[model samples]
Target: MSDAQYTLPKTNSGPWNTRPFHRQWLMRQANNLFDFFEAASLNPKGGFFELDDAGKPLDGANSTRQIHGTTRMVHCAAIGSLIGRPGSGEILDHGMQYIWNQHRDTRRGGYVWSLDNGGVKDGSKQAYGHAFVLLAASSAKLVGHPLADQMLADVTEVINTRFWDASRGAVKDEYTSDWSKLLPYRGQNANMHMTEALMAAFEATGNKDYLTKAEAIAKLIIAEHAASLGYRVAEHFDENWVLDKNYLGNEMFRPAGTTPGHWLEWARLLIQLWVLGEKRLHWLTDAARHLFRAAIDLGWDKVHGGFFYTLDWDNKPVMREKLWWPLAEGIGAASFLTSYDRDDYFQIWYRKLWDFADNHMIDHARGGWLSELKEDLTPTSRLFVGKPDIYHALQACLIPLYPANGSLTKGIIEADHTAKIAH
Candidate 1:
């Protein structure tokens, strides 16, 4: 595919003109996900890995060296469900094996954050990691995995013991192996992720408490972190929910401003809650709509095809580079929006996503998607290739469910092409 051939379609002024093409596009995207899962499952590690150009495993030198344990678990569960594969069960079992034998803090209740190549605990306990554990466990249950019940119980016990802050009525961010809360109670990213994970857990187990917590967090976003003027979710906060303006060495929540990525992620969870018929359906819907509109107004790049990485509350661009994750999130939010009655806005985002994926992120010379891109639509990083990791690939897999023109399938092809290029 030549760059000249990759023009982004205009935002729909009225309804979308090509409805049938969109359905076919989604079907093809679903097929691509099936193909991705099939290839990823053949590895002996029983989990996915990031592959180099020669399809060799990336070196495992430190904490960042190995495929993230939580990422592997979520991806395995998602792809497994998408393709109707029993191996997803095996993958979930493999993750549980690591948690039980390697990372389980018996003195505490939750699992450790990272494990070394030998499967020994290598890091402290983190709420973010535990959220993925819940997500994987819940997904396993949805797909008829036999051990799902036991996994659910184990994770539930962990959540109850370590992360749950009973006095505060909210989950804490991280802790020592003995269940001591880390100072500062930072990491809004963990809260955002847990909100999403809780949505999945509520679906899997019919747990009203999980749904209630998820709703509470959504309410928290509106009450505590939301900027009164623009409705953007604030990036960082202390235990009492005081806004922390200082950068303060927290790499996880950086750029010190409102971000499209986090908003998009939050929108995803809110939509999930909306679909699940949570009592606060109208509130959830309004929150998602507000975030979606803010994300587009602030982060979208008009000259280029995709969104900027992050933006401040004033709608000024912060990190102009287009990170891989936001694009995935954008596609997800746009796809979800397409299911609603707002067809014009949906087509705009849908076309923008396709154009961005085609021009910048897609590796036409190779296969699969690139990790990141410059604001000018240039490749900036390469992390994962065909070797499966859940986040981006899962987003790609979900694109087909939304109504779109053939552009969405073309986006899938670009993802495959990027993977091929990396290999």
Candidate 2:
């Protein structure tokens, strides 16, 4: 068929679309491009260097601002997995060495979250940081690192000692330096990321324990936060699971009055878990269905081409701006939905997302992708976008890997036509 007449196949349920050749190329390029982001943190002493705005090393002696060594370690592991590199293993090794040498709290049995830019552990132990360490350890295993197994054990030890809450059936959000629980705080975002980290750990070790933990977390999310209208994940919560409403500010564009990024990420993970043939297919399927329905109904910008940043719980648009990470998640969700069941609207949504990113997020005049954009598809901020984070590029590169469904492609082409007319 001619290019103009090309159309993809359709499935009976869910969304579908045709995969393009450029999708594979995009993924490869993204993998290569983001490799540098991971490499720049390497230090000769088996510890990664934390760089400041000027690219100078920030150690405790040099700067007062603390850096989370866990973040650097996680970035290495993630980037390594994406690029098929041994560098990720090295980064993890270095990070572990630093933790062993300086950050470890022997009395507490968990790594502290931050040290002065110089590598001194002076901060509290954060659930988010520990989660990243778990993720990195899992990723290190993927790259053939021998220490990865021990790292996984360390993950379990840390969680057990400091974060895991048997009564709540979920992990606590944070702890003081001495491992005491920090009250009046739990977070949906932290739970979501922890679930993802656990999933990775399960994948790496073939351990049923990790998978079990992941499922438990997923169940808690469904039971507590997953709502009928939308999955309302909050920024903060009291120890008893009460959401802190004061943190809800109108300053940033919040689509549907919630963070779309978290929702999309959860949806993507649920779909992945379902595909993994885990025990919770029903839960996974329900999550995928609800998240996509809610995201589309609430997160999407009807007047514009892309998704907004946040929305209220009632599905009204709260944040009007589009962010790059959400676009990546949108592609992931659309791809998965299309795979499970083909629908014209899903195809249209995917196409609109790509078009919006191409027009707004991509820096044609400069280089790399822009992090955020205005509702009119213009650049709103360059802070995160221009810097080239590895995660965004890696997700962006996966577009071509999705199987092309004919009906979805046709829907996309038609959507392009509609967008032109509306313009």
Candidate 3:
């Protein structure tokens, strides 16, 4: 194809022209998600409520809130608010207050794990939730939230002092309520999120320390850990940050085998890191390409269309169920690779993944994307109930439209600003 033919048309009306059509589709999806989740999810008492089968917010005893879920809403709302969405600022404020009043441990330093209508449900301090806290604060800062800076500073201190293990080059998993004792188990899952949060922190605060930490984590997880394990990131780990390939922990987060979703996520993040780090580390691009191929080779369902949730050590599908977020990450990773390399395969993968999401994961009648589905593309709530979080899906839509900046928050802001000037 010629250069002009190689480029997609800028017109919005098209079938699968990635340049304009995909970006426009993403904007519509993101706007729809913000509108739906904001209207259908706001809790009467506090943080956003999880929706039920019928898409209504769950109430009473079913209204139990997780810290990660609450923080994800905050992060998404912050992004919406920054992009000029109406009513998102209120949700951002509400989420920040919920984190401060309900989730934070006054006696201790870190945030709690979960909460109910009554009070604290799980008092454990998890690195996963803390990572979201960092992400939420970073995005909130972009929207000029009053408490964002304080929350960012507080969470940064907690992550660095309590969770980060400088010697191991990875963060620890969890801690007790009083922050007295650290958990023996370690996890790259939490660390992966931490890497994401740290990159956002670098963008929000302009702190080189945060960027340095993020680079270290990317090195440890991708280059050191996954490189040795056939580019399949090891989820569970011991106190020394050694991969425990045999560890069978939480079926959802820390599964026994590898999650294809995470490989895609890491690939996208590595690309961002490569660009953000001034392309100093040439190997990050190679690692990202390798990781994306690993995910495609092992996690993709050949018979079916969607990506599998997990794969066993021998590359067999451990969990055949297809979650919405993996496809989201796949779209993002494919977009990033195609943007940088101009690889036709990545573009094809990007179009195919978006088509899969539109066919199955996206809710045509309802506003937001469906959370999970079975192998037959039937909606299933086995692993996830309702739309637990919009972070992944929202990013999937937005990330493709922007360049691979240090973080999504920064990219979105810059893209919005540039669009406004063009208009």
lDDT at position 200, candidate 2: 71
Regions more than 4 Å wrong, model 3: 1-18, 59-62, 419-423
Q: Which stretches of candidate 1 lie over 4 Å from their true place?
A: 1-21, 30-47, 53-55, 60-75, 85-92, 166-169, 227-229, 248-255, 278-280, 382-388, 399-423
Tens-digit lDDT track for model 1 on 1-423? Answer: 323234334653433333667656544554554444435433354344455433444544332322244444544554455444545555555654554555556655667666555554545677777777777667666656665677678877777776777555567776775665475666567777777777777766778888778777666765456636466777777877677765444433356666787777676667666666533467776777778777776677867757776665567786677776777777777666665535456556666676667677654454455666677876654322333344554555455453322222223334556668999
Q: What is the TM-score of each candidate against the true structure?
A: 0.80, 0.76, 0.94
Ranking of all predicted structures according to TM-score, beginning with the best and ending with the worst: 3, 1, 2
- Cα lDDT computed for each candidate against the true fold: 0.60, 0.60, 0.84
Candidate 2 runs further than 4 Å off: 1-20, 40-103, 248-257, 277-280, 314-319, 364-366, 382-388, 399-423
Which candidate gets the maximum lDDT versus the true structure?
Answer: 3
**What lDDT does model 1 reach?**
0.60
Among the numbered candidates, top TM-score falls to 3
RMSD (CA, Å), each prediction: 7.6, 9.0, 3.4
Record all residue pairs in model 3 with backbone atoms less than 3 Å apart, i.e. clashing: none
Which ten residues in a row are the worst by lDDT in model 2?
Answer: 403-412
In the range 1-423, model 3's lDDT, one tens digit per residue, is 531135444462232335576568789999878877886777878887887645688664458889988899999888887777899888889999999889998877889999988899999999999999999898888888999999999999999889888987778898889888888898888988998898888888889899899899988888998999989988887887777878988877787888989999999999998888889999999999999988887888777778888888899987889998899999889878887875556776777798899898888887678888888778898988777777888988887777566566788788778888999
lDDT of 2 by residue, 1-423 (tens): 321233445443323233345555565456554444456656564455544322334452333322244444554454455444555655556666665555666665776765544555466777776777777677666656666678678767888767888777678877777765575667766677788777777667777677677677777775456753356555556788776655553243221247766676677677666655443466676677677666766677777667778666565666677777788877767666666654455556666567666677665543446667788877665323233344554554554353322111222334455668999
